[model samples]
Target: MERNLMKGNEALAEAAIRAGCKCFFGYPITPQTELSAYMAKRMAKAGGVFLQAESEVAAINMVLGAASAGVRAMTSSSSPGISLKSEGISYIAASDLPCVIINVQRGGPGLGGIQPSQADYLQATKGLGHGDFQVLVYAPSSVQEMINLLTKAFDMADEFRMPAMILADGLLGQMMEPVEFPEAKTHQIPKPWATNGTGMKRKHNIINSLYLTPEELEKTVLDRYKRYEVLENEHTEAETYLTEDAEILVAAYGATARVAKSAVIKAREAGVKAGLIRPITLWPFPKKEIVKASENAKHILVTEMNMGQMVDDVKLAVECRVPVSFFGRTGGMVPKPSEILDKILELGGAE
Candidate 1:
């Protein structure tokens, strides 16, 4: 089927509905408000629930309640709103309920601006909330990728029995592009542990984050980490470009990677060997792929819309084998291809 043009936020909303997402709970915030608005109009037509909660806090908790009942559920917001939902996210994580969350990020230290930014890298991949838990995170570079990720986001949540996040920026959310939706998932693995009301034939189920005994909590945490290790090994994904014989390797994600790829092409045309590695999944962070991509490179550059949040992860992956440098544009500003090329040239990448 031919694809249709759509804004990233609207595409994601439609994708979630097609993914069999039965419930959506969210509070409106800029850059992401269109997502909730789209859901409000379409979800009801699809026989699903679209709720505009009073606050981010209330919305996330409502998601928790619905997901625990074995229904596919979701919530979305921007940076500050995501911060408000963190506590509830941690609770959902601890309770092992499955749900999808979207963060169409904006500038921030505090209510920074409604403009596009990737400042929430650390927050999404690292310390989203207080716990040893890790959520699967996907960063989509375009509106089409947003649809693909949003559809898969629900299955990942259900398959792992944990929260999964679609980490996008305001640029992707606001822009429009052609996108195609895969057919609705026809078969889903049943979640027996869900707190569906018990009938007379079965025992009652409970879903809660509390662990009154330290020993019990310790065991639970350890078990969860074991599961994460397995997930990290199996799910890490990234796209590599021109790395086979490049001298300088650029690492980026989301919309920034698209810009970096343009610079890489320009560099190659100018007789400079440059390549790119765009991480598709952020949490299981394609570490080995990055290490390998830098094998023949003279230098590694990490570009972001934030002040180098993901650079730390890149450094850890590179393991000091090659020099790693960072260039960024914060406060809602995005870097252009020429700007990234300049940084590449400054790193002695010019041939």
Candidate 2:
């Protein structure tokens, strides 16, 4: 298939429809508005429902309602709106529903700027809700990957019977590129466990996770952990470049990763054995891969659009055997390749 040019947001919308997402509920937010707009126009043709909920909170709840009916539902919002949706997300997680959410992050700690930022790394990986639940997070660096990730997000949600998120930033959401869809395959159907209501030949089933009993809650938590273990083994994926024979390795994801690639090239030209390890799944954190990369590297440089979020994960993955460092810019400013390279040189690690 020839690659088709698409903006990241549009690509996600198209992928959602193709992946059998029949319900969409969302309110407008910058850097991701195009995603909803595309859905509004295309959903009808695709036999999907695209509803513009009155607010982020409403949008997320609408998704919860639709998902409880066993329909593939979705919603997209930026950081501030995402914060509002978090309350409902807790409910969705508590209910053990299957759905997809997209957070095209922007600068934030508040009504932060609507520009590219990696500040939400911890928020997405941590429990967004009050419970001991997890969100399957896909961190895509390009429009093509953004499209591809949405497809995978649906699959994971059905397989694990949990919510999955495509955690992209404004940069990746707004960028334009050519993307080719995966080879034709029938999108898998959700398990019969998915509720279609119980009035015919089946008994009624309730899908809420709100157990009042402490013993039941403990069992639920342990059961969810077991499912996550399956994900950690089967779904975690990452990309590594030039790691072999490289004494210095750069770690990053999304737009920050694209910037780090340039640094890797410059360091290589300067006779330094510098490489890159780009994580595609932020939740799983690619720990095993980073640990392997650490064994052969002397220094690991973690770069992000925020002060230091993913660096903490890198540090944990590598442990104290190797030195891990960080460089970043926050509040909507993306670091330049040359600037990151300068930091690498200053560390005396870029050769």
Indicate which candidate wins on lDDT. 1
lDDT, candidate 1, equals 0.91
lDDT of 1 at 170: 95
TM-score of each: 0.98, 0.97
Residue 327 of model 2, lDDT score: 90
Segments in model 1 whose C-alpha atoms lie over 4 Å from true places:
184-187, 349-351
Candidate 2, 1-351: lDDT as tens digits: 788899999999999999999999989999899999999999999998999999999999999888888888999999888889998898888778878999999998899898899898888998577778899999998898887889989887877888899999999889999898887642676556666766687877677767899999899889989988988887778898888876788899998889999898897888777888999999877998988766678888889999898877888887767898889999999999998888767665443
Report the lDDT of model 2 for residue 144: 85
Candidate 1 least-lDDT 10 residues: 180-189
Model 2 spans with C-alpha error above 4 angstroms: 348-351
Tens-digit per-residue lDDT, 1-351, candidate 1: 888999999998988888889999999999999999999999999999999999999999999999999999999999999999999999999998889999999998799999899999999999889988989999999998898888777888888888999999999999999878766562467988888877777888889888899999999888888878988888889999999887889999999999999999988888788999999999989998998888898899999999999888988898888888999999999999999998887775454
- Assess candidate 2 and give its TM-score to the true structure: 0.97
